[model samples]
Target: MKKILPLLLIVLFSCSVHSQLNRTFMGKDIQYIEKNLKMKANKVQNLDNGLSRVIFIKEKDLGSSTIAKGEGTLDPMTTPPVSKKEYYTFILDNEGKVIRTDYQKEYEKK
Candidate 1:
């Protein structure tokens, strides 16, 4: 039972951590998302015809992946490449309800 207890706790913790962003946000109101997910959008763009887009940016370091081409030795002086940023965008209708969602990840320049 001891082994199972630790495994179960780990599973539950991971589930809550990973639930921050998901497809279930579709059709949910903006307030519900902010309160539940504890996330504030980085930017919001208002579109024509009473539509708006909410964007949340999350940046994470992916660590070094550079391969030495000269002597197969990593250079200590060189800096690692910038990691990709996650963009979570939600399109809301005039009534402030989520209508669609989009997610993308790409490396951004400093």
Candidate 2:
């Protein structure tokens, strides 16, 4: 069982590392959010009223899946290079406290 213990620990650690951000930051200020996020946001926008929007994006390469030019030129079926994007949006109040959070995941063809 010695080998199994090490494998189990690795699995648990990896799972925690890749887990999504949680909403435990509700009502917390922007600085707190930034600290926990551990990454800078891709975009930030000021919205109507006293609310502001903060967006964090992460992109993952899905490898090249494109077909050869001449090989698939005549064929109508062809796969394009694609990437996966994850978006996390946070809405903060005038006081810079987080009011709401959103998450979006999508695949884009390049």
Candidate 3:
């Protein structure tokens, strides 16, 4: 009974330490991304090939003409240019530094 009690306590202690380590690692990753990438990203999704995906949202006005209350007939502009770009995914390392970046790029085969 004495030996069993000690083994149980050891297991519990190890589990607690593991959980703490995990939290620290996550915090470090968050800090790295915020500092290096200058982005407020959270909740990383790990993908195959050792890549992580991060999501962020940004707001922007339509345009000066559209925002103006009194204008010479606000003509609907075709696809207003993106004032702010939203980073959908960002590949990061253990330190959370961006190792690679991927934007909109469709593959075409001729």
Candidate 4:
């Protein structure tokens, strides 16, 4: 039982992490990107080398953005005067298979 418990825990954790990606456009084809990551995509670009990027306003929004756009929002008055958007990048192969996912570095808020 002890050995089985540890193995089961590892399987569940891995599934959780992978589910997070599966819930989004990650590991999916580029054709579905717009439908998947639109509203929060202040910007999106597809590169020649099978790389696509979607940009969002805040770190917290970045999470929601991946799941679906408009899931997160910012208040104009509370928002900082100078702020930058977070970038979510997807790497795909020639056949349009998602290779990996990465995010831009988050800078400290002043």
lDDT of each: 0.76, 0.77, 0.52, 0.57
Q: Where is the poorest 10-residue window by lDDT in model 2?
A: 14-23
Per-residue lDDT of candidate 2, residues 1-110 (tens digit): 99899999987775553343444677887778777777887898999998899988888878665465665366554576789998878899999988787777799888
For residue 34, what is the lDDT in candidate 4?
A: 49
Task: Sort the predicted structures by lDDT, highest score first.
Answer: 2, 1, 4, 3
Off by over 4 Å in 1: 1-22, 65-79, 108-110
Q: Candidate 2 regions off by >4 Å?
A: 1-22, 64-81
How does model 4 score by TM-score?
A: 0.40
**Poorest 10 consecutive residues of model 4 by lDDT?**
60-69
Which lDDT tens digits does candidate 1 get at residues 1-110? 99899999988876553354455786788888777657888999999899999988888776656454677565534446677887778899999988877766688543
TM-scores for all predictions: 0.60, 0.60, 0.36, 0.40
Error of 4 at 32 (Å): 1.3
Give one digit per residue, the lDDT tens place, for model 3 in 1-110. Answer: 98899999988875674454344334345565466545676457887766666654433444433344455665543444345443334566655655554333222222
Query: In angstroms, what RMSD does candidate 2 have relative to the true structure?
Result: 8.9
Q: Candidate 2 versus the native: TM-score?
A: 0.60
